[model samples]
Target: MNLREQISHYIPYTTQETKEQEVILKYMDTFDNLLARENESAHFTASAWVVNPERTKVLMAYHNIYQSWSWVGGHADGDPDLLQVALKETKEETGLTTISPVTENIYSVEILGVPGHLKKGIPIATHLHLNVTYLIEANEEEKTTVKEDENSAIKWMELEEAIEACTEPDMKVVYRKLNDKLKNYK
Candidate 1:
């Protein structure tokens, strides 16, 4: 598949992502429906590092489950178009009507550990996310609607502010990579 090969071709830029790539690729090779959220063991997820049209700010959501500011994204849900997943998740979570990929190529990838948490009155065990990242360019003027079930608020923030706003230590590297890469994006 295009996604599989693309991910394989993506050279990790950080030592952390580099080390995790082995585990990510192992799961990728071992699973058929690895992108499905219901996989439980682990699965693919698509995330957006959303930037304003002027490229001055990044968008983030106050995640209900994580209880912290984070990039907008969701499970692949059986879909391999991770870019589409990122776009859909951005709009669904932030109500941004104007958004397009900065580039169609894979921006970043990592194996992320999701701590056990309860959702919808059910308990979910700890899992890993083969998280793929993409950069999106969106208009700052677009009105955003809250995704009440997933997030309490959504806002465009400066890169430093956005990174510091997140409380998850593991996610910080993801955000930093996105931010640093995006700085060089046209």
Candidate 2:
């Protein structure tokens, strides 16, 4: 089995009861299966949850394509370890090299489907994001520089507003889980 098949073997498909189960199932059955057949184009990626020291806020980026506020992350490219992928993507997107987990707490996986490319007008294959979110604490002196190519803007926002601003419901779930995990630290 190839890398894509290996990864897909571990990822669970959305069950029948899931709200988007049909869509996910169809994609998993079709797009993902086909992508698994292609050796050259398969990809895996990760993302991070860069929370502030106060615990009341988290860093987010205004995605250019989606035009919505979202967390900092990008494609893992060749990084085999998903955790390292998350860390690397977070650093690349947010320019925070010293960021580390607040309590060594890692969170769940989030899956998302990549829409068709705007310029190419070709349907992009489904992407399974084995996201391992971390509660990172950074010093006040650490300067933040948003990578403009990846994100239009970046800022620290109140957790509540961050959750509300997220367009994806699964991301909202991620925020809630992160919030719950941080409660013990308070």
Candidate models: Cα lDDT each:
0.87, 0.60
Q: Summarize candidate 1's per-residue lDDT along 1-186 as a digit string, tens digits.
A: 588787888778777777777777788789888988778989999999889877779988999999999999999998899999999999999999889998888788888888899999899999988888888999878899889999999998999999899999978877888888777765
Candidate 1: global Cα-lDDT?
0.87
Model number with the top TM-score: 1
The model with the greatest lDDT is: 1
Model 2, span 1-186: residue lDDT tens: 433343443323223113333333344455542222242233344567777777778888887767778987666555545556677777888788888765433343444556544523645554454343445665535777878876877788887888898887766776766666567554
| Model 2: lDDT to the true structure | 0.60
RMSD of each: 1.4, 6.0
TM-score of every candidate: 0.94, 0.67
